[model samples]
Target: MKITKLTNNISLKRQLEGGNEEQLKTVRNVLQDVRENGDEALRKYSEMWDGIKLDDFRVSQEEIEEAVANFDEQLKQDLEEAAANIRYYHEAQKRDGYKLPLANGSWLAQRIIPLDAVGLYVPGGSAAYPSSVLMNVIPAQVAGVERIVITSPAGKDGKLPAAVLVAASILGVNEIYKVGGAQAIAALAYGTETIAPVDKITGPGNIYVALAKREVFGEVAIDMIAGPSEIAVLADDSAYADEVAADLLSQAEHDALACAVLITTSEKLANEVAEEVEKQLRELPREAIARKSIENFGHIYIAESMEQAIEAVNSLAPEHLEVVTENAESDAEKIRHAGAIFVGRYSSEPVGDYFAGTNHVLPTNSTARFASGLNVDDFIKRSNVVYYSEQTWQESAPKIARLARMEGLEGHARAVESRGWTKGDK
Candidate 1:
C-alpha cells in the first residue's frame, strides 16, 4: 500500500469520476443491437461474452427447484437468516402514501406505488453472490414490487449458481433468466420474446453493465450507476492495526480499481496498519487482485488531528467508512458523508455486507455525497395527487393567470383564465 501525507483535495476529488467514452460506446452498441434484434441479440451476445449459447433465456421452475434441492442445507439456513434480517430492516423503510387537506376544499396528496416490474442483474460465472441476491431482492419484496425478475450470466455449463438460484427462490422470485452483461441489461430494458421489459433495473456489474445502465436509464428507471467498491477507514491511536488492515483488504479484493484508504492521526498506527496490510495480503485467496488494488489506489493519509481525519473522510465520501477510534460512535457522528459507517473494531464491514441487515449495495466512487444505498424506495414510485374544487379554482384563478402571464406564457394564462376569471376581470 502507498503512504502519503494529506495535501491537495483535488487529488481526492478526481478519483470519484467514473466511466469512460470507449466503454460507453461499446455498451451503446450492445444496447442498440439488443433494441433492434431482440432475442437474437441476447443469444449472440451471450455466446460472445459468456462463451455459451442458450436456447432459452428464462430459467424454468424445474431448474430453480433442482438448484434449491441440491443446495447445502447449512448455507440455505444461513441465507434464510440473512434474508429475514434484510427484510426486517427494509420493512421499516417502507413508506405509506400521504394526503394533505387544503383550505379551499382541495387536497394534495402523494400516491406511493410499487413499480409494476423490476429487473435484478446479478453477476455470474466464477463469482457467486447469494448475499447480493438477498440484499437486492428482499427490498423490492418489502416495497410490494410484485414482478421481480433476475438476469445472470450462465456458466460454461449453461447454468446459474445454485446459491443465487436458491436465494432467489427463497425470496419468492421465480423469474430468473440465463443472460448477463450489456445484452442482459438491453433485453431487460427493451424486452424480448422470453424476457419482459421491467420498470426498473437494479444491481452491480462490470464496466459494460454500468455503461449499459447509463444508456437505458431514461427508457427504464435504474437504481444508480455504481462504480468499483471502495472503503475509507478513519482510525486513531486506539484502533487495532490488524483489524484495520483486514477491513481495508476486504474491499480491495473486490476489484483492481477498488480503493482502500486509511486516515489516522497517529503515524505510528498508520505504519503498523501498512505493514499488517502487506502481511495479510499474502494469505488472501484473491491476493493478486487485492495486491494490485492496494498498490494502485490504496492510500494511508496521515492527518494531524481527528478533525482533519474527519475532513478527509467527508471529502472522499467513500462507499464504506469504518471508524476505529476512541468513542467510535461519536467520531462516526462527525462524518457527514459515507454510504455506510461501521463503528469500532468489532463492527466490521462484512457484517453489513452479509448479515447485519444493512444493504451492501452502496453508493460508490464518492456518490455518497448525494446518492444513497439501495432500499425499498428504489422499487417504488411517488406521484403527486392534486384535487381542486370549483371554489378553489375560482379563488386561485386570477393569481395563477398573473403568474403564468408574467412568464410570457399566454396559453398557460388563458388556460387558467378559462377556469373562471378573464384577464380584464382580474
Candidate 2:
C-alpha cells in the first residue's frame, strides 16, 4: 500500500468505479437463454460452468440431513450461535402495519406485507460463504416469509458445501437448489419446471451475478446490485497500525477489485498504516489477490484535518467505514454515506460480517450514497391504506377535482365527482 496526499476527490472516486460491459453482455445472454429455455438451459449452463450435469437441481431432505451430520460439532455450534444472534437482532427490526387517524375524519395506513417467497443466491466454487446463508435467510424468516429458497452452484461432485447446507438447515430453510451464476438468477426471477419463481432475490455473487440481478430487477425484486467488497478506515494516531492493516487486508483478500482505503489527518499514521499493510500482506494466504487489490484500488490519503477526513469519507460513500479516532463515536456521527459504520478499533469489520448480528450484505462501491444494506424491509412490500369518510370526501372533492383538472385528468375529476360530490359542492 502507498500513502498519497489527499488532493483531488475525483481521483479517489474513479478508483471505486466497477462493472464490465463485456461481462454484462454475457450475463444478458445467459438470462435470455434461461428465460426462453428454463430448466434445459439451466442444466446446460450448469454443466458448462460447474462441470456437473444434474437430473434434479433441488437438494433433497436426505442431502440436508447428510450435510448436518457431516458438519463438525464446533462449526455447527458456532453457526447456531451466530444464527441466534442474527435472528434476535432482526426480530427487533420486524415491524407491523401502522394506521394514522387524520383530523379530517379520514384514515391512512400502510400494510407491511412480507413476500410470499424469496430466493437467496449464495456463491459457490472458490467462494462458498455459510455466513452469507445465515445473514440472508434470518431476516426473511423474521419478516415472516413463508418460503425461503437458496440457489448455489454444485461442485464436480454435485454436492453443495456442507457448511452452507448446515447453516440453511439451522435456519429451517429447506428449499435448496443446485444452480448458480446468471442462470440461477434467471431461474429465480422467471421460474422453471424444477425451480419455482420467487417474489424477490437477495444475496451476493461475482460480476455475472450482480449484472444478472440488474437485468432481472423488475421481473423479480432484488436486494441490490452489489459490487466488489470494500472498506474505508478513518484513522488517527490513536488507531493501531497493525489492526488497521488487518482490517483493510480482510476486504482486499475478497477480490482483486475489492477496495481498502484509509483517510487520516496524521501523515505519520498514514505512513505507518501503509507500512503495516505491506507487512501484513506478506503473511496473508490470499496475498496475490490482496496485493493486486491494494496496488490497483487501495489507498491511504493524508488529510490536513479531521473535518477534511470526514469530508473525504462522505464523498467516497464507502461500503464499510471505520472510525478509529480519539472520539470514535463522535467522529462516526459525521459520516453521512456508508453502508455500515464501525466505531472504535475493537469493533472491527469482521465482527459485523459474521457474528455481530448485523447483515453483511451491504451496498457496495458508492451505492451507499443512497441505498442501504439488506434487511427485513428488503423482503417485504408496503401498500398504502387510505379511507375517507363521506364528510371528508365531500369537503375535499372540489379541491381534488380542481387539481385533477389542472393535470388534464378529467376522468379522474369525474371519478372523484361520481360519489355525489361535485365541483363547488363544498
Candidate 3:
C-alpha cells in the first residue's frame, strides 16, 4: 500500500472493465443464439461453458430437499435468520400508490406495481453465491415480485451448489436454473423453452455476464452494470491501524481490480496502516489476488484535517465507506456519496454484506455518486396514471397544442387538438 498526501483533485474512480471488441462480439452472439434457439442454445452453452448437461434447467423439489438434507443445520438456521433480517430491513422500502385530485374531476396518480418476474444472476457455482441469492431474492420478495428465479453455473458434475439450493429453499425461491454467463442473461431477457422471460434482472457476474446484461438492457430492466468491489475507510488517529488494514483487505480480496483506500488526518496512522496492510496481505488465503489489488490500487492518504479527509472521500464516492473517528456517526452524517457507510469500529463492511440486513449489491466505479444498492424499488415500477375529464381537456387543449407545435411535432399538436376543440372553437 502506498501513502500519499490528500489533494483537491485526488480521486479513486476505477476505469471499469468494459469488455473488449472480441468479448462484446461473443456476448452479442450468445444473446442472439439464446433469443432464437431458446433451450437448445442454453443446453449447448451450459455444456460448453459450465460442463452441465440437463434435460431441463429448472431445479426440482427433490433436488432442493436433497440439498437441504445434505447442508448442516447451523448454516440453514443462519441463512433463515439472515433472510428474516434482510426482509425486515427492506420492508421499509415498499411503496404504495397515490392519487392527487385536480380541478374539474381530473386527477394524476402513480401506481406502485411489482414486476411480474425477475431473474437473479448468482455468479460461480451454486454454493459459491448463496449470500448473493439472499441479497437479491429477499428484496424482490419484499416488493412482492411474483416470480423469482436464480441462475448460476453448475459444477463440473452438473449439480448446483448445495448451499445455494438451501438458501433458495429458505426463501422458498424454487425456480432455480443451471445456466450462466451471457446465455443466462439472454434466457432471462428472452424466454427459452424451459426458462421464462423476466421483467428485470439483478446480481453480479463476470465480464461476459456484465456485457450480456448491458446488451439486453433495453429489452428488459437490469440492475446497474456493476464493476469490481471497493472500500474506502475514513478514519482518524483514534482508529487502530490493524483494524483499518483488515477492513481494507476484506474488499481487496474480492478482485484483482478491487480498490481499498484510507484517508485520515493523522500521518502517523497513514504510515502505520500502510505497513499493516502489507503484513495482513501475507496471511490472506487469496494472497496473490489481494497482493495484486493492494499493490495496484490500495493507498493511504494523509489529510491535513477531518474536513479535507471528508472531501477526499466524497470525491472518491467509494462503494463502501467506513468511518472510524471520535464522532463516527457525526462524520458519517457529513458523507453524501457512499454506497454504504459503516459507522464506528463494530459496524464492519462484511456485516452489511451478509448478516446486517443491508443489501450488498452496490454501485461501484464511482457510480455511488448517483446510483444505489439493490432494494425493493428496483423490482417495482411506478407508473404514472392520468385521468383527464372532459372539462379539463377542454380548458387545457389549446395550451397543450401550442406547446406541442412549438417543438415542431405537428402530429402531436394535431392529436392534442383532435379532442373536440378546433383552432377556432377554443
Candidate 3, 253: how far from true, in Å?
0.9
Name model 2 segments beyond 4 Å from true: 8-10, 16-21, 103-105, 421-426
| Model 1, residue 175: C-alpha shift (Å) | 0.5
Instruction: Tell me how candidate 1 scores on lDDT.
Output: 0.90
Give me candidate 1's TM-score against the actual structure.
Answer: 0.95
Residue 102 in model 2: lDDT = 80
Ranking by lDDT: 3, 2, 1
Ten residues in sequence with the least summed lDDT for candidate 3:
417-426
Give the clashing residue pairs of candidate 2, or none. none
TM-score of each: 0.95, 0.95, 0.95
- lDDT by residue for model 3 (1-426), tens: 888888887666766567899999999999999989999999999888887677878888999999999899998899999999999999998879999999999999999999999999999753387899999999999999989989988888777899899999999889999898999999999998889899999999999999999999989999989998999999998999999999999999998999999999998889899888889888889999899998888888899899999988888999999999999999999999999999999999999999999999999988899999999999988899999998999889889989998999999888877767444553
Candidate 1: the clashing residue pairs are: none
Candidate 1 C-alpha lDDT tens digits along 1-426: 777788646356435446688888888899999889999999998888889989988898999999989989999999999999999999999889999999878999999999999999999868899988899899998999889999999999999999999998888888899999999999999998888899999999988888899889899999998888899999999988999999999999999888999998989989999999999999999999999899989999998778878988999999999999997999999998999999988999999999989999999877899999999999988999999987898888889989998999999988877655434544
Q: For candidate 3, report its TM-score.
A: 0.95
How many pairs in model 2 have backbone atoms within 3 A of each other, for residues 3 or more apart or on separate chains, i.e. clashes? 0
lDDT, residue 311, model 2: 89
Q: Name model 1 segments beyond 4 Å from true.
A: 8-10, 14-22, 420-426
